[model samples]
Target: MATVENRQVVLERYIEGVPKVTDMAMKIGKIELKAPKGSGAFLVKNLYLSCDPYMRGRMRDFHGSYIPPFVPSQPIEGFGVGKVLDSDNPDFKPGDFISGITGWEEYSLIHNTSQLRKIQPDDAIPLSYHLGLLGMPGFTAYVGFYEICSPKKGEYVFVSAASGAVGQLVGQLAKLHGCYAVGSAGSRQKVDLLKNKLGFDEAFNYKEEADLDAALKRYFPEGIDIYFDNVGGEILDAALLNMRIHGRIAVCGMVSLHSISDPKGIHNLYCVVPKRIKMQGFLQSDYLDKFPEFLEHVTKNFKEGKIVYIEDMNDGLESGPAAFVGLFSGQNIGKQVICVARD
Candidate 1:
């Protein structure tokens, strides 16, 4: 193994409101890309990087998040697809494709080779898909729908942020399970893509509807049996009022509450008593044991045209900051990815 030098994107400081360019910075440095002698670690050449809303939680100076905040003046890390450049581990080899936790840099020395799975490139799915459709967001959709929602055939399923990475797949999965599915998104284009392109039974632009509760009542006049919630706050409050008996609600992420001072309060909790609704918050990590089962189900659906995926990719690592900040503004149409090195 040889020493290697690489350039990386590092978080410069903790941010408030929307993050500016100064919040993160880039640096070039020298280091051994290869693991230490006899360390059994592998070095990876970074490729596609996922820019997700959840990363915002990691940027704040808080201890309540699932993960710790990024240290100042260091490279921020998250899920990324990469190819192995050097290896001292038995399970991984040079040139093997993988996707897992890595830094926003050109190269990373990933220890604990057991944590990185070798991706079969011949599967014909995009390697980038590992970050979205066939990855965390995909698993989030699967667990939330089948396990949390406990959906039944012919039931009505309502999804908020329906055109997003997780929401799109959840709606499609609900359809496959014989449920009537509808999605609400922020833009008209997303609404069209949901109903006309993604096979959602119905779709609406939440921005266009001044009254969310009124809008939900119109779409689910029969009442909602399953609510796959991605954006909480007033939306959650609205959905609570329209739930059917023994309804299920999976709280995946609360993107709406992330940037605000005081989050919207829910006032319709009384409906839960009469409906006996099951509302549970979940993290994708909680269902890692079901990864193989989820992969099989989602891959079959993808090949059969029962599921479709969308990605909004920017060209370089330098664009990572803006691409991430855009999630709050509804700028990305689908999963947001940043391409640092394609080959």
Candidate 2:
């Protein structure tokens, strides 16, 4: 077996509030390019890594989350697309591409292949899309919009964090379902992308809106049939106020509260009863049984030009920390993916 130097993004310490690049340090370690005999593990070279908002929860010392916290001084784990190099597992073999939870490093010895999917390479779809458009974020948007939102044709839908990884697809899926889709993003650029590139019916810069309630009213005067709440805070309150009768709210993310120590409460709880809105929070992990169906739907639509996905890629393993921290500040335009290595 050959020994190789592996460069990894290691967490220096568990964090509080907003994350900083200094909290994670890049370190070099050596690994044998082989999976141990009878270990049921496969060694892989990570190609692309996903930087998602949920990773912030792992940076804290909380164990109550759906996922476990990152162990400090180790390479923090996330979703990645990798190429198998050596395998002690019969299901995976050398030269196969797989996507699942892997370390933020050059090479990973993946132990649990239970959730991992073997990718049959398609030239029409980029391999990196496995971490974004065809992966967890895409699946989140699918399950949330179709299953949670329970959307109907001609319904009015509003998506917060609109141009983000999950929200972008939500808005598009709503449009495809014959609904009026609107999205709210932080910047004018993201707003433009939402409306023009992603085909949302309308988009607004949330930062420019002084009153979110008024903003929602303006966009959804008849009231929103579905509200994809990505940034919970004032936006959620506003959505609550504007929800039509029997409307549904898919609570996707809380990027707004990651940096806040003292977060404010939503003031529109009473509206839920009066409006009869169905609001639910979900984890993509919960709906693992539906992954194959989701993949088939997305891939077929994507191949037929009925669906499109956008990604904001940062190159190299060394850039992982900065790319991750940038999520809090909304620096990346779309799905933030770190290209650790390219085949």
Candidate 3:
């Protein structure tokens, strides 16, 4: 079989503090198109690669996280959509469309077939949505809100990083559940996107708010009943002060503290005692059994125009480093995706 050139984004070393594009380098390598006999690996041509904040954790040498750290001088692996080119595994065959964890490269030879999921294409929905709305981000929002927060109608819901992948969906889901929804983003544009485009009842630029506690109080006069936290730090501390009795806080990604050497402690955790609040940290994989139900509901809402998904697409493998780095800086307006190939 002929060997083809494979372009990849490789981590140069373990990252400290916030990540930069310089931390990763693009390298070219060659690979055979076919999976070797008895290898049990499937060869796939990656289509869209997702750039998520969680990936920042993998860039470090941390051992406590659910996913392992990225190996130095190797392709950074994350969620991506791909089309099968060859397979030694019976479960996946040539031309099969799948989305899961794959290397940030033009093509990947996946040995762990269990992580890959077959994509049943819907012409009405773009295939790239598999990396965002119909995929992990959407599922994360679903599980965090329903399973973790247990939101009810007429409750006040607030989402940090509101214009982000998971936050945007959580706010929309809160609104759909007949709860009052509010979101906070880093910029005015993203704040506008939340209130104007994403149907959040209220949205604010947290960077502009000098007093976050006052900001939360201004938006939620009755106190927030459900807080879907994405960017943890002072915002979480402020939210704790404004939470109503028996309020629930779903601890999702803490992007603000991810890169901090010594993360600031949350001072208002004592409020949880007085309010009888429930704050829980969760992972999407914990709710895998509910994926089928989540897919059906979210897909239906998407097709009916009841929900909207926004994505910031950076084209080519060359753009992967910048796209990944942009997450920490809040440079993306929505879900950050790198389009590596169409097929």
Q: Write the per-residue lDDT of candidate 3 for residues 98-214, one digit (tens) a residue.
A: 999999988899998566699998898889999899899999999999999988899999999999989999999999999999999999999899989999999999999999999
Alpha carbon lDDT of each predicted model: 0.86, 0.91, 0.91
Model 1 TM-score (2 dp): 0.95
Alpha carbon deviation, residue 316, candidate 1 (Å): 1.0
Off by over 4 Å in 1: 1-5, 113-115, 259-262
Give each model a TM-score: 0.95, 0.98, 0.98
Q: Taking the candidates one at a time, how many backbone clashes does each contain?
A: 0, 0, 0
Model 3 clash tally? 0
In the predicted model 2, the residue pairs found to clash are none
What's the true lDDT of residue 329 in model 1? 79
lDDT digits (tens) for residues 217-256 of candidate 1: 9999999999999988788888999999999999988843
Better candidate by TM-score, 1 or 2: 2
Worst 10 residues of 2 by lDDT: 255-264
